[model samples]
Target: MHSLPESKKNHLWRKLVWHTDTDLHPLGPFHLAEVYCCDESNGYAIWYVRRLAKDDARGVAGVENADYLLQYFSKNHRDAAIERAVMLANADPSADKVIAALDRLAGGAQKVSADR
Candidate 1:
């Protein structure tokens, strides 16, 4: 739909810089990037991306690049991706009481994943 403002994009870029360089063990960092981008907006925005992605791939038969989320996450992980995404999103400052909530979730996720 609408292009995000440069300022907003810049902010997101800065926030993501730390994560972009992480080693791709489970998956590459770009998938995480896509998930972060998709989560930046509300539910309606995610729906719009999905709808457009579907439309964009209507003509393609076998190539799996049609689904926006799938395409976005192709470079990284698929399983538990949404869960990780939700955890990352909670780190957004706009979420009230986000610091405590995000810390808990992030810490918990790290612990869980560490044992894997």
Candidate 2:
């Protein structure tokens, strides 16, 4: 449940606005993910630990690069970028397991009661 510090979030938001001309919220919390500037481009990359399931015991981590100025400049770019970031965050080596888990969740997996 870790979150970026306010200063860091502001920095990221500034960069996004400067590059994309879109004033959008910064990335939300993902316990095993981090966002940073890419050394090779004027863009940001996300490094994340990929898990096959929400409660998976182990994870495979890697970095995914996306160009904000180039790949995310459209009107709907914010939503698209967020979706891509989420997909990258959830990426796993066991693709089938990930797909199955996603399918189950999309098809209405059981929900836990908040009071539990």
TM-score of 1: 0.21
Q: Which stretches of candidate 1 lie over 4 Å from their true place?
A: 1-80, 87-93, 109-116
**Among these predicted structures, which one has the highest lDDT?**
2
RMSD (CA, Å), each prediction: 16.8, 15.6
Q: What are the per-residue Cα lDDT tens digits for candidate 2 across 32-93?
A: 22222221233343222221224434322221221112123233344444555456325554
Error of 2 at 95 (Å): 12
lDDT of 1 by residue, 11-107 (tens): 2212221222335444542321122333233221111011112223232233222113321233244334444455554555443233233333333
Estimate candidate 2's alpha-carbon lDDT, on a 0 to 1 scale: 0.32
Model 1, residue 30: what's the lDDT?
Answer: 31
